[model samples]
Target: MRKDVVPVSSPSPLPPLSPPAGPPPCPPARRVSLPAARPVRLVLCLSPVLLAGCWALADRPVASEGASRLAAADPGWLLAGAALTCLTWVAAACVRQGSLPDKLPPGLLLASQFAAGAANHVLPGGLGAHAVTLRFLRARGVPLDRATASIGLYSLARSVTRTLVLLAFLAACPARRRLGELVPDGPVPVPAAAVAGGALAVAGVLLTVVPPVRRPVTGLVRAALADARAVHGRPCRVLALWGGSAAMPLVQAGTLVCVGTSLGLGLPWEQVVLAHLAAGTAVGAVPAPGGLAVDAALVWTLVSFGAVPAVAAATVIGHRVLNDWLPLLPGALTLSALIRARAL
Candidate 1:
């Protein structure tokens, strides 16, 4: 009908918006069952009882006497001994730091070491500190297996170095005698010492050799020969670590000598070193916190072998005060810092 052609502009179709993906599947919503709350209630009720027992132990006659004596020990000797211990820990930290692929900060690692040491003194069983150290390393991305292997290797290296140093000391003073009175006719043979030395040698050799372990054991041997070349591939650093580790025992033995001299026990350095090593090794097997009972027993046994009764007791007591308690304050503080920092 001749209507004028009109142009119709239809509206453009709108694009549909898809719904946003839901919260990434909610991660399967792991169901975590926390520990029952009963133990917390029990602890709240019994805490006072536990504290009372601690007080009782602290109030014991022997504990009181020891505390008094510890308070009265020479400040200089205590400071010097503490300094040596700090040096030992530093060496340990250095070795650990050197072994890592991504080396941890030196300060943090040292803090962890000190914290671990403090824990070793307070916690039951010998592995407390080591466990803390492993956890610390694990948190920092070191695989558990590798961390354990590294720590074990470092400990072995330290022990080997210590043994070698002790042996060298013995060799240098072969004629040394115990604290017992001189025999009118001749010296009594110390069969016990000889047996101990022989046993140590055998155990050390067996542990160092053998297959499967032969790999790591071989590493130790090559490291020793090339001076840690096989381990870190840097002989000088490895040798330095070993040498530093050896110095710890030497300084420790020297502390014993100082104790003997101060207490007028007149115990020979060689005799003391032998006894010290034996006692240290034996007591280390004990599970008590810091090997407290074990350490006391070791000192008593070592000193009693030849020392005059009173002097021996005094030396033992004095050594504990000078060596153990004095550094505990700083060690504990360091440990606390580590925990607070979550470095260990």
Candidate 2:
């Protein structure tokens, strides 16, 4: 026992562990690219509005005329007009959101609407905006069929509301009835209408003949109708859909009033509103990009309302600069950004 104890002295304590080779060089101080990205991001952020302004100024006489009128414009009235113009965009956004069943981020929804304004100018019949919005809704994870349905519902609602609002105004202001006589006596061309109908019929026949086109179209129509019914079932959606649509034309009319006032066009306010609504309804369906026909009709309508020819021309031209052309640049910019972000 004594021999065993002498041989088996307790194991000596182990030495302490040392720091790992100078802390492994402190992980090479990772470089952050945040600063580099900042200025680029800032430029991108500002480019849209700047682009919009520059593009607006590029339109030779329209931009120059608008600027001239703005310079002499009663600051108060011009400010009001600007405010109303801004609200029209908001209304458009609200309608879009309301039409969708899936919840959308308000900011993005608003952005899509802002972008849509430019697209309307690019394609006749609002094809560009419709295309953008359809893509946007799909990006938001809405089913393709429902998105299509919602867009259809939105357009239908807008067209109907415009008519209803016009009717309401006509009911309220009987004096505006006299202006209806200004509608030209020229008959619509039967041959043109017949040709358009023939083309549509041929297209329909082709759709029926082509399985690829027919299947998806049939499914889309069914899905869309179902979604539309679902949307109509919700009262809040209904209100937003129709209410926002109804307010838009009124705001547009208000924009015209402000423009007229700026140009010293001495006309009855109600008459001006009536004239705009009437002209819009008359020429809105024609496939003219930027509504050349609508612009002409508006000028003619104003002249019929006893506005001087020069004043009528100037007013329509100025409002076109504001309502249509002004939004194009910013809208295109927004569209580009949205595409990059995968939101369109």
Candidate 3:
């Protein structure tokens, strides 16, 4: 019997199917120890308390003296001075804004200025504030060249405007024209020339000696000039930059004037204001951070104008306590917050 040839179609072998790769073995988890992060967290939590405790222990005597002086002072005038002091923050914020082309969070900007006052007291020559602002704008994505240029503009405008304001006040107010009384009775020209010449020589020597910094110096010069041109192109920016700078000194002096009056400082009002301007100008180049030089200068100037020494000291102390000392802690905390947010 011939078996019919049967074609057996072997079932086609099934194509191999593989399961989806499970997340490629998740390269071993980073073994982050909680201990590593705790110390930082702990420090952040405790810094304020420690700072306050140290300040309290150190400043009790000064605080007592200041409190006594303020207690006896005219509350109305002191209050007005404080109110004006607050306005100075607003003015500072305005100046900072004018320095940058990009708009920043207004609340943060205002807070920065307030915080900057603390920095001014802590660091020499406004370096602390400058550092904070530079960092802030950099975080905001501003170009380094432009941010640096803004700083230059702010500084130049502040110095130049201050001088202009001082001159204008002396010219318009004949009462203040007696600013010559500030100098001792001698030929001022010789000493003045000597000082100027000495300063110029020192600056020239430094620039000549430091060749490496010249590259940045050159770039900064160009950037500053460019920013100046850009600012002039916008009238609002011009006003904010110059106007805010111009008003800053006046408001600051006004605080001193108010404090002096509250404590019965016996000088013409213009004389008090002029005294503040003159003293600040004199010690401005000194690296005395905060108001150390300035406070002494104010006290001396008031004494020269026939105010009682104790009373003058009290006024200076009171003003310092209000503007510089009181706000430090909160300002520091604000600075810390900004830093954490990467806005500083």
Candidate 4:
């Protein structure tokens, strides 16, 4: 009986179950670290002005001379030159868009090209601009290969169009004989062409023989060809590509003509245009940033065209001011805005 009672005694109360541990009260959501946009924008806004001031100070003599010349130039013609300069960027944007099938925001596309002008001056062979564009395309979800192909297509189209334009101008221009004189008659070109061709052949042979190199290169070529076909298939793209390419050189030439007129250069507009096209086509292969060699070539060509050296120099200075210096600050600002907005 006693044993049964003992056994019957209520089992010791079970230890109070500890509350099941929860995910350590989920540590207060960590705030995502992000760049402060306001400070970045402020810096972006100020940096260009500061840099421009420094640039002016560093070359004060040239800046002062340029300023005086610009002040003396005809404002009307100068304004026209500025307008033409702006159109060049628009044409560039068109070519860029035409290179890819994916639709990009028109506003941003224009802005990017404007920004690209500044970048183009900083790096040799337009690498800075291409880098900006590549980043932009990547941000917009374009595949790396496709984006790269687009750049190649754009460059190819531009070069081909430029050459065609040059030929056309040469045939139509009354000054073709003079331009022909500018080309030094030598065996240098033949050797250069042979070297280039041999290099290409070597590269091709390597690509064909090496499996590791062959596969990626072949794939890239296929992709590029496919994109090119796709781009050409659309009428709008074709127009934008070829039309923009054609328009860019013309617009640029027009700018030079306007600058020449403003400075009272003796050469006719037609001659000025011809000289610009010739100089650009000739020196374009040189890897000088911001077309330094092209500038020198242009001045030389203009002087040969019977322009007064002083006037030609002044004209070139004005053209550079309108085409390059004026836009640089704004372009840098646009680039900064794009970066801040993550559009690039």
lDDT of 1 by residue, 1-344 (tens): 79898999999999899879786555667788668765775564444335434533664664466566546556666566556666766776776754544457777887777656655654666475678688888878876556776667667766777677656655675433442222234433477578789998986777767566657666545544442334467665565466656666777767766666655666676777766765665456567764566567655656556677666666666666556555555666665555455565
* Candidate 4: tens digits of C-alpha lDDT, residues 82-120: 899999999999999999988999999999999888777
lDDT of 2 by residue, 1-344 (tens): 46555566899999998877764555667777888887776676555556556555555677687667667767777677778888998898878876776678889988998888877665788787788889898898888788898898889889999999888878886667577577456665676689899999998998989999898888888987787777688988788888999988999999999989988899878888988999899888889776788989999888877889988888888788777776677677887788668787
RMSD values, in order shown: 8.4, 7.8, 5.3, 3.8
Using TM-score as the measure, the top candidate is 4
Candidate 4 regions exceeding 4 Å error are: 1-60, 209-212
Arranged by TM-score, best first: 4, 3, 2, 1
Q: Per-residue lDDT tens digits of candidate 3, residues 262-317? A: 98878777877877887887777678776677878778877876788998889889
Model 4 lDDT on a 0 to 1 scale = 0.85
Give me candidate 3's TM-score against the actual structure.
0.81
Descending-lDDT candidate ranking: 4, 2, 3, 1
TM-score of 1: 0.64
Candidate with better TM-score, 1 vs 3: 3
Candidate no. 2 TM-score: 0.78
Q: Which segments of model 2 are wrong by more than 4 Å? A: 1-58, 175-177, 189-211
Off by over 4 Å in 1: 1-63, 71-74, 98-102, 174-230
lDDT, residue 131, candidate 4? 91
The ten-residue window of minimal lDDT in model 2 covers 48-57
Candidate 3 deviant stretches above 4 angstroms = 1-35, 41-56, 174-181, 184-211
